[model samples]
Target chain A: MIEAQTLTKRYGAKTAVDSISFTVQPGKVTGFLGPNGAGKSTTMRMIMGLDNPSGGQVIVNGRPYAKHKAPLHEVGALLDAKAVHTKRSAYNHLRAMAATHGIPNSRVNEVIELTGLGAVAKKRVAGFSLGMGQRLGIAVALLGDPQTVIFDEPVNGLDPEGVQWVRHLARDLAAEGRTVFLSSHLMSEMALTADHLIVIGRGRIIADAPIQDIIDGQSKARVRVRADRPQDLLGPLAGDGVSSQVLEPELLEITGVDPRRIAETALRTGVLVYELTPLQLSLEDAYMQLTQAEVEYQSHSLSPTAPDTTQLTIPVEGRRP
Target chain B: MSAQTTTSPSPTRHAPRPSSGITFSRVLRSEWIKVTTVRSTVILIASTVLVMVGLALLGAWGYAQLAQSINDGSLPADLQAQGPGSPAVDALTTPSSGLIFGQLLIASLAVVLIASEWATGMIRSTMVAVPGRTPALLAKTVVVAAVAFLVGLLSALVSYLIAQPILGSQDLDFALTEDGVLASIINTGTFLALVAVISMSLGILLRNTAGGVVTAVGIFFVLPVIMQLLSGLADWVTDAARFLPGEAGNKMVAVTASEGALTQLQGGLVMGAWALAFLAAALIVTKKRDV
Candidate 1:
């Protein structure tokens, strides 16, 4: 398990990671969610004891990473792919790390095989393609059989097949009762792979909950109502805690009310409802809303193109505004 | 893709942790592996050894010719007055001459071993593996210093032993048994080791290859030259310049200290001060700063 308490990192007057606190529990994959320069990488570096926090501290297992007698056994982190010396072969790179811990060569070769790097393990890392370099990073992370595995943007340069492999690998690592924490700027990537999420924006914790809770709490649940007499149903659906939008001539999108209530209203009012489907909120939508106000580097358009959906999440209740 | 190839192995692939995690020996072993694993680094190291030995052999040949001139009484009056057979004696010290040029290559080797890690972003992995930080830095220093010193010592021995015949032609035998000669040869190796240590400290402090190389070259080569150009203009210039790392190293490894030069012990102390200062700075910066 990794626990960061009130960690802060500042460069001059600009704060990179400003007093953020979170805990990554064991036996589950906790996805670190943030946009670029949102302190995700800085937080991970601090957790690994690579970067010293300007304030507060991060600890792996029960102690700070450097304080552990066997740090690699406690936590293994891949902060960046292609962090190997270009002059050395991948095999030597892993071997050197193993030597520090008196870890055996058999395990080095095992991680190499596990990460699909056996084919090019002997080649110099300078010649590796991006995907191959990423695989080597994963191999290094797995070399110690560490209890907590942290990967920062592991699939940044992977192919579709390789991406699929990483997604499963993280889940499998967690299934073996390890604390697995991964970070990605791509919300969709975390949505598919993460069991729980810790979202940060502008170096602060924006949201922390289970994946399902984040999707439900940050975004309103919309219901798709299709009926032969949809206009008649719209009148009955107009009430407190209920809002409707006309998606089509025969279809209405209703929010802030359950489908059962809509179905009962249609029956009591004699509206001929053909279909009632509850719309599921994708994690992507939830993330966009959660971080829309906190995005640090934003592209400002001089004029409108299409509706700027990524920039502004549509508010469900205009009554308060 | 090759996971199937491991099917015949033991069912469990989990690694058993060693009892001691950060033993100095293990860190040293890891450092040795890192310093020797690169092909270019290996080639450069081998080249340094060959150059050390090769230059001594060439200097021996050149000194043999110079011995004949001194014996024929063709040398200048003032040159002869400095010391009747100083050229021949200095000629027997061909290994120190080789060290002048050889230190550059070996010092550069030390710089690249550490600074290039930052250039290629490999320092991240290195720092991650050994977050205690000093062990890795000190381990790297020990490995490079040991290799450079041993190579230098072997070259000095071969050079001194082989130069006997050439210097004997002029009846000038600066024997290894002579007072302070053996110590000079040993100091020749120690000076080279100091060069490596100082270069590595510069590399770690700068964390940039070009910058570290420039600073090392300036300290070893340029500073002494600048001191010489200003020598006659100021009394303190010559004396102060004698404490620079290169000049101090020269005095420390000479058969005897020259006129107006520091004694061997004083010279060694000065250079040691330099090496220790650099090392302390590197350790402090490494520990206090973010990787």
Candidate 2:
């Protein structure tokens, strides 16, 4: 288990990680989700005792990481894929790391085989592709057989197959009762792999709950309707918490109301409803809704100077004067 | 894709935690592995020994030729008048004559060993394994200093044996039993070991290979030259320069102390003090700063 109490980190005038408190439980996969530079990496580094926290402290398995007599046995972290010396062969690199804790070379070779690095285990890491580097990083993390495993952007440069492998590996480790805390910027990936998520934005905890709760909480029911007159149905649907967007002259997408209600309104308005489909909000959409305002490096859409005003309209409740 | 080969090993459920952990000896072993695994470290060590021994042979040859000239009375009267100290007695210092270059190579090697970890981002892995930070740094220093001492000791011993034949040609050969000769040879190792500690401390402080190398060269090479150029300016300049690490360490390997110069014990203490000071600062800074 990892517990951070008011952990904070500040670089000069910029606060990279605000005072945040959370706990990572064992026996499940906990995903740390954040956008770029949102302090996910910094938080992980702090947990590993690589960076000193500014005001608070983080402890792994009941003590600060450095205080443990056997730190490697308590927590193993792959903070960065390129953390190995490039001049050393992958086999030697793992051996060197294993030596600190007196971990046997047999375990080193075991990790090498488990990570599928046997083919190039003797080759220098300088020649490794990014995917191969990630594999080596994973191998290093697994060498100690720690109770808690932390991976930061483990699939950054992996292929689809490698990505799937990491997902399975994470789940398998958690199934074995190890604390698995993985970080990623992609929420869709978390949706598939994470049992619980702790989302951060701008150095603050935006959400900390089970994955399903976050999806269900932020995603209201949205429906698509094809009618003879979209504006007629939209006018009757205009009320508190109801928003509608006219897609075309006769089609509209409405939120905060179910499809059956939309059909009832369309029928009462004497508007013919040809297509009425209830749209399920993807996790990506829910993630966007959670982080849209907090995105530090928000990119403006292309052609911002000239928008197609006719094609889009604000919800009736949020329309400007 | 090779991902198909990535199989999950059944993690031994509740395997008894191994009793071994990050002890100083284990950290030393880890650091030794790190030092020897890099090909360049082996090459540098080998070259240091070779250059030191090679330079001693050259010095022996030069001293032999000078003695031959004095014997034939072919030298100018003024050149010959400098007396026994010129070639015969000076042969005792030949075993360590390569120290001038040996220290340079050893200093560079020590700096590269520590600084390259930061350059290649390997320090993270190192710090993660030994998060207390001091043990890892201390172990690396011990390993590096031990290697340097062996390099210096072996170089001097080999030089002493190899130079004997050449020195004997001029009747200038000496025994290890000669007063201070054995000490000088062994001190050659002591001197390089001190150089290694100081350079590795610089590596830890700077955390940049190029910057560490430059700073080490400045301390050991350029500072003495600058001191010499300014020694004529004042008596204090000359007096204060004697305490510089390079000046003091040079005296440690001397066959005989010059008039008003530091003795071997004094020189070793001064240089050792400097090494300790630098290493202490490095450890304190590293403990406080983020990796």
Candidate 3:
């Protein structure tokens, strides 16, 4: 398990990782999610003891990484795919690293075959493609048979087959009761691979929860209602714990009230209700709703108008959940 | 849907053992493997030996030819003895003939040995394995110094053997068993070791191969010349120049007192101080900097 408390890093005047705390538990895959420049890499570096944190501390398996007796066996990290000398061949590179821990040569060959790098194990890394490089990086990360593995952007340059292979590798490793922490900006990949998600924005934790909870906790749910007097119903519906907006001349988007309650109210008030549709939110829409206000870099092409929060009704053909 | 569950038999025995503690010998072995496996390191070692032997042979041949020409009346004897300490010059010539260039080459090799890791982003991997950092640096220093010392000694020996025949042909006796010859060879080897250590320290400090090499060369070559040209400004400057690493190391080999200069022990101490200071600075900087 990896635990970080109040970790922070500052470069000159700018802060890269502002006092963030999180823990990565064993027996499952924890996904570190963030936009570009959101302190994911900096945090990983601190955990590896590569960069000194300006404040706070990070512990791996109850001890600082540098203080561990056998750091390689305790934690294996692939911080960057190209953190290798291009002149050295893959086999020699692994051999050199293996020599440090007195690890046997047989284990090096095992990782080679396991990562499907057998063909290019003898070739120089300079001649390998980006996908090949990622494979080698994974091979090195598994060199010591470490219990806790960290991979940053492991699938950035992989082909589709390689991508599937990495996903399976991560899952299998986690199934063996190891701590698997990976970071990526691809939400779709995270949705597929990560059992838990820690989302950060602008150097701060925006959300930390289970994948299902993150999907369920977003505030984008709404019930769409259509009536002949939608304008007249807006004032009465705009109260505490209930909000209604006019989508069209006859359509009203209502929040904080279920479709059955809206229908009953309309029936009791003698309002002609033609349509009542409940919208189920997608993860993408939830993510947008949560991060739309927290996004730090905005493109010039975005118009001055805010995002449309009003719900539009589609013709009801079936009952909604 | 029914949840299908499939299970495999448990292991008959316990799981594998976790890795044991890290040993210093393992770190040393790792560093040795790293230094010896690189192609550039192999080439540098070979070239250091080659250049030293080649230069020694050339210098020996030239000296022999000059001595013969003077003996045969082809040149003036008074003119040969016109320079002070001509016998001392001829006696000490072959041992230190390859000293200047050999030290430069080996120093450059040492610089690259440490600096290339940083330049290629390999230091991260290295330090991850041995996080203490100082042990790795010390291991490299020991390896580089041993290789350079052996190379320097072998080159001087070869030069002595080759020069022995030429001197015999000229009816001039230059003895390898002589006191001065032995001292000179041992001193030359020690000098090369010092130069290698200095270069390795520069490598650690600069962390750039080219910058480290150039800085080492400037300290050994350019600084002394500049000091000599500005001797009129202050006599202490020239006195200080004698204590420079290269000059001080040469003084140890020649076993001759510099006129109104530091004693032999003082020279040795000066060279040792240089080595200690550079290594210390390199260690401190490495400890503080991010790998």
Candidate 4:
């Protein structure tokens, strides 16, 4: 188990990670989600003892990381893929790291074959591709076989097959009662792999719960309608926490109201409703809703004439349980 | 990328034994592996030995020509008047003469060994394995310093053997049992080990390969030349310059002490002090700051 208490990090005048506290439990995969520059990498670095915290502390397996007898065996982390020497072979890099803990050479070869780096284990890391580099990073993380494993952006450059492999590996590790903590920008991948989640925004925890609870809490009834007059159909459906976006002259996407309510309103108002469709809230949409206000580098769409692009400007007020 | 790669064995199979952990000896072993696994380190070490011995041979040949000119009465009037010392006594320094270039290469090698870890982003992996930070840094320093000491000792030993024949050609040969002769050969290694310590400390403080190399070169090479140019301005300048690391280390390997100059023991102590000061500052800073 990994526990952090009021962990804070500041660089000069700017705060990279605010005073945040959370716990990662064993026997499940906990996903760390945040927007760009939201302190995901910095948090991981502090946990690995690479970056000193400005305040408070983080503990792994009942003690601080450095206080452990064998830190590599206590916790293994892949904070960055480029952490190995470019000129050294992948096999040699693992050997050198393993030597610090008196780990034998046979185990080093085992990781090499396990990561499928046997074909190029003897080759220098300078020649490895992006996918191959991720494999090497994973190989290093699995070298000591610690009870807790942390990976930051593990599938950033992986292919589809590589991505699936990482997903399964995370699940398998968690199933064996190990604490698996991972971070990724791919929401779909996270949805498939993570059992629980700790979402951060602007260095603060926005949500911490089971993955299904997060999805359920951030979504409400959303309905899409095509009618002769969208404004007329939306006129009576404006209150009760309801909102609508005009997609076209005859189409409207409404939130906070169900399709049956819209159909009853159209029938009572004497408006012709051609189609009424209710959309299920996907993890991507829920994530956007949760982090819309916390995004640091929001990109403004340049194509202002696009009809569907108008919804991007709407404010999403988070409704939490 | 293969499907079978994901089918890793259980964590229990790879769990370390209860007795295995981070020890000073284990850290030292890890550092040794790191130094030898890289190609640049091996190449630099071999070249240091070769260049040191090769330069000593050239020094021996130059001294032989000088002794011949004095015997043939073909030496210039200024050269005859300013003989500095007998050519026989001057030839005693031939075994360590290569130190002129030896120090440069050794200093660069020491800086490269530590700074390259930061340059290639390998320090993160290193620190992750040994998070206390002190053991890993000290282990690397010990390995590099020990390698520098052996290179210096072996280079001087080989130069002494090969330069003996050339010195004998001019009747300027000296025995290893001569006063201060064997001490000079041994002190050559001691001086280089100190140089490596100081240079590696610079690498840790700067944490940039080019910056560390430049600063090391300035301390060992350029600083002495700058001191020489200012010596005529005041006697204090000349006195203070003697305490500089490069100047003090040169005295540590001198065949004979010049009048009013630092003795071999005093020179070694001064350079050792400088190395310790830099290393202490580096350790304190590394402990407090982020990697």
Candidate 5:
């Protein structure tokens, strides 16, 4: 298992990872989700002991990574695909790493064939394609057969088959009761592959729960309600935690509060309710909404006409939980 | 200590064995693999030897020609090429003379040994495998120093043997048993190895290919020339110049001591001190900064 307690990393005035705590349990895949620059890489680096945490600590198998005499055996991490020297052949690179742990060359060749790098194992990594590089990185991570494996953007630049292979690999690793934590910005992929999710935004944990619960919580029984008097009903219907938005002159979309409550509120306030349609959001929509307020490098498109663009004029209210 | 293994019905298909501890000797082995596996390392090492021996041959040839002219009584009557010392030994020293330039090439190998890891982003893998950062670096030092020393030794032996016959024909007094002759040849190798260690320290401390190479060159090549020029202007400059790492190392190969200069042992100590200081700085940087 991998556990991080109030782990933090700050560079000058900018905080890459804020004090955040979470646990990655074995027997399931935990997808670490974040927008770009959401501290995913920094957190992974700290976990690998490649970077010192500004505060708190992340432990793999109940100890800091460096404390383990054979860290590669305790935990395997593929933080970056470019970690291998470009000039070294993939076979030689793996052998060199294996040598440190007294691992034999035969195991190195096994991982090579397992990762399907046999054909190019002798070729220098400088010539490998992006997918091939990812394969090599995966090979390195699997070399020691650690109880916990962490990969950062493993599927980035992978082909469709390669992506499916990684998904299966992660599930298989977890199925064997290994703690598997992998990061990705692709929500659809996470939806398909992850059993649990730890979502981060602006260096803080936005959500950490089972995948279904997060989707349910974010897309919580949203219903479209049509009323003749939105302004009159807006205040009376706006109970604690209930978010209601007027879609048109006679249209209202409501979430957080159930449909029955919205109907009763409209009836009690003498606001005529015409239509109510419940809305279910996909994981993509859920993630976008969850991180809407938290993205650090929020892109402001020149096409202001695009609907659903977040407001640039006013400060976003307290971020949604 | 081994990681706590919880048997929770792991479905993992890959077979995993108990992890062996990371001993310094294994780290040395790993580092040796890292050094020898790369094509650049092999090429650079070969080049270092070639340059050293190649230049020695040229230097020996030049000396042989002058000696020949003296033997033939061709030069001015007052000019003497091989007066007393073994002209053969002098010729044997010619090939190693190229080591003056060959040291840079060897130093380049050392610089790339550490710096290229940073440049190519391999340090992450290397550090993760051996998290005791100091051991990881020291391992590299041991392997590179051995390789450099071997190259230095090979170059000295080849140049001395090849130039031996040429100088012997001229009736120059030169033999391995001669006082200081064998020591000079061995010291030449030691000097080359020390250059590599110092260059590697610079590579780790600087962590940039061009920066490390340039700094090593400045210290070993440029600084000595600058010191020589400054010596004429001040006596203290001479003292300081002799103490400089490159100049001090030069004394290690000197057959005869110049008055008011450090002995070979003192020179070796000074060069060793420079390597250690740079290594300590590299370690400090490794500890203070994120990889």
Candidate 6:
């Protein structure tokens, strides 16, 4: 288990990570969700004892990471994809890291094969593509057979197949009762792989809950009603708790009420309903709602009030709404 | 309940793995692996030896020719009367003729070893592997110093062996047991080791390969020249210039007594002081700064 209590990091006047606290328990994949420059990498570095925290502390398995006798075996982290020396071959880089922990060469070869880096293990890392670099990083992270694994933006530059491989790797590692904490800007990916999420925005924790709660709480449930006289039911549905907006002459977008109640109201009001579509909000939409104001950099054309309906291209099956 | 328990283990089970203690020997092994794996390190050590031997051969031949000219009565008697000191000078010069050049190469190699990690973003991985910064830094320092000391010692030995034949033909054989000859060799090795330590400290302070190399070269080369030029114009400046590290190191390398300078032991102490100051600064910077 990895626990961070009121952890914070500030660089000059800019606060990279605010006072945030969360625990990553074993046996599940916990996704750290944030946009670019939202302190995901900084937090991971602090946990690995790479960067000194400005305040608070992080503990891995009940002790601070630096205090661990065998840090590599206790908690392995892939904080950056290409942290290895570019001039050194992949195999040599892993060999040096493994030498630190006295981990056997067989384990290094096993991880290399496991990450599909067998072909390029002897080749210099400078020649490897970004995807291959990510594989090497994962191979190093798994070098010591660590109990707690932390990967920051693991699938940033992966192909579709590589992306699936990482997703499955994270899930399988979690299934083995290890603490799997991964960070990614890809909400759809998180929604698929993460059993729980800790969302951060502008260096502050915006939401920390189970995936289902975030989806239900932040995203509004809307029902599309199509009828001959969509305007007729607008008055009854437009009450204190109910809101209805006309999308077209025959279609009404109704919120603040479930589809069942809307359907019952339509039946009692003698409305000829042809279409009753309940819009299931994707995790992306929910994430946008939770982090709209907290986004550090806004594109010129992006409006804060605009609804987020952009399709998320996740490679996993069974998680798409 | 018994059947359920027999079917599967409890899902809430927690098994904490045993801790593996950090060993200094393991850290040393890691540092050794890290330093030897790089091609730059091998090239630098090779170049140091080659330069040392090449300069020794050149110095030996030049000295032999000079002695022959004096013996043949072609040169003035004043040159011969400079006396026994000449052979000491000749023997001392051969072993360290390439030192000025070789020291820079080895020092730059040391700088790159420490500074390039920060430049290439590899220090993050290193620090993660060894969180206690002192052990890592000490391991790196020890490794670099050991390699440097070996290179310096081997180079001096090779230079002495190569010069032996030429000096023999000139009727002036250098006894390895001579106080000046042995002092020069041992002092050269110590000086080279000192230079490597200073370079490693500079590397940690700057954390940029180019900056560290430039600063090291500037201190060893540029500063002494500037101090010399200034001393020639003023008497007080000449007195102050004696305390500079390069000047002190030059005095430390001399096989015979020189006019107006600190004793060899004092010069060594001055060099040691410089190394200690640089090391202290580096340790503080490294300990306080983020990787």
**Of the candidates shown, which would achieve the greatest TM-score relative to the real structure?**
2
Please say which candidate is ahead in TM-score: 1 or 6: 6
Residue lDDT tens for model 6, A127-149: 98999999999998888788899
Best by lDDT: 2
TM-score of every prediction relative to native: 0.90, 0.94, 0.89, 0.93, 0.91, 0.91
**How many steric overlaps does candidate 5 have?**
11
Could you give candidate 3's per-residue lDDT for residues A99-155 as a string of tens digits? 778888999999999999999998888898989988988988888778889999999
List clashing residue pairs in candidate 2.
Answer: none
| Candidates sorted on lDDT, descending | 2, 4, 1, 5, 6, 3
> By DockQ, who's the top model here?
4
Encode model 5's per-residue lDDT on A175-238: one tens digit a residue. 7788899999999889878888999999999999988888777677777777788788778767
lDDT (tens digit, per residue) of candidate 1 on A233-276 = 77877888778877678877888889998899899989888888
The sequence of per-residue lDDT tens digits that candidate 1 reaches over residues B67-183 is 676688887777667754556566746766688778899889999899998999888998888989999999999999998888778778877777677666666567777867888
In candidate 4, chain A reaches a TM of 0.90
Which 10 consecutive positions of candidate 2 chain B have the poorest summed lDDT? B1-10
lDDT of 6 by residue, B1-291 (tens): 012112222234333334343567777888888887777678878888898778878888888888788678787778777656565366556776667877888889889999988887778888888888778888888888888878877887788887888888987667778766677777677777878889999999889999999999998888888888887688988887777777677666666767678767778789879888888888888888888
Q: Write the per-residue lDDT of candidate 5 for residues B1-291, one digit (tens) a residue.
A: 011222354635343455576889999999999888988789888887888888877777777777788678787655564355445445545635867887888888888889889988899999888877989999999888888778877888788888777666666536777766677788888888899889999999889989999999999989989988888998999889988999999888777666888888889899989988888888888976889
Q: What ranking of all candidate models by DockQ puts the best one first?
A: 4, 5, 2, 1, 6, 3
Model 2, B1-291: lDDT tens per residue? 112222342334444276758889999999999999999899999999999999999999999998899899898888777655879778889999999999999999999999999999999999999999999999999999999999999999999999999999989999999888998999899999999999999999999999999999999999999999999999999999999999999898888788999998899999999999999999999999999
Report model 5's TM-score to 2 decimal places.
0.91
Cα lDDT, model 5, residue B229: 86
Assess each prediction's global lDDT (C-alpha) against the native: 0.84, 0.89, 0.78, 0.87, 0.83, 0.81
TM-scores computed on chain B for all candidates:
0.88, 0.93, 0.88, 0.93, 0.88, 0.88
Chain A TM value for model 1? 0.86
Candidate 2 vs 3: which has more lDDT: 2
